[model samples]
Target: MSQADACLRLNGVTNKNITISNNVLYCGSQLSIKATNDLTGASVYNNAVNGSISATGIQSCGTFAISNNVFINATANNFYPAAGSPLINNGANPFYQALYDYNGMSRSLATPTVGAYEYSTTNNSGCATTDNFKCGSSTASVPQYSLIS
Candidate 1:
């Protein structure tokens, strides 16, 4: 939950095609990525960070896209964005075409949400698409909630 140093400190390392996405970092007192130097081709996007991010002297990432990051207070009980949050449907689809979220559910191609989870209109429990009524239920008129955990 906390660390003395940066949660994702990338120092003095050379790498390419480094894409950081869909992560939930709850750091009490640390930065996310303070890449000092030698790090390249790094794209930090679609993550929930409770701290700061500093990337200096990154050479090969001239076109690296750092977008759709949620930086907020970690005191909240849950990390999900509230209704009509800017984090919803705010991220651009990566060129890599990330197929799944942290929950292993499918992602929308047109408008992908930010953070580690993707908000879906239907629960992704792989149940019947029509209704989420429990098995052997009497009443079939009720519709299950659309929000997935």
Candidate 2:
């Protein structure tokens, strides 16, 4: 997949809450926003992708959380670079924070960063500030898995 393509795309038109969880999105070349407004709330977790991914536009506006996600550029072409790719810590806007790092560590940024994995500032094994694994206040466990191999 190229950086010009978006495997999963979401655009909000109203000031409402949006939640996305336990989904598998592959080859996404563009941006992915969990929620787009103050009344919005998005959760992304346990999903796997084979290309660059990003989440933005969720700062003080509402709740935008990305957790337990695995994104890799398995393509042989390596169409995008690490720095220029959308997988960077903060590609579009710096409003989205990283609740968990790539190493499964608990962390958060001073400002919201980009990508699915957030660098953990504290410990690797702890509760994430955004809580991407769980959707909203519900305790019901919803598990999903996507295999690319």
Give the alpha-carbon lDDT of every model: 0.53, 0.36
How many steric overlaps are in each model, in order?
0, 14
TM-score (all chains, Cα) for each model: 0.55, 0.28
Give lDDT tens digits, candidate 1, residues 40-115: 4566556655666676643332222232323222243334444465556776666665666544667777787766
Query: The CA-based lDDT of model 2 is what?
Result: 0.36
Top-scoring candidate (lDDT): 1
TM-score for candidate 1, residues paired by index = 0.55
At residue 4, give the lDDT of candidate 1: 59
Q: Candidate 2 regions off by >4 Å?
A: 1-6, 9-15, 19-73, 76-98, 111-113, 119-149
- Per-residue CA lDDT of model 2 for 75-111, tens digit only, reads 3322122333333343222333334443344434442
State the lDDT at 128 in candidate 2.
28
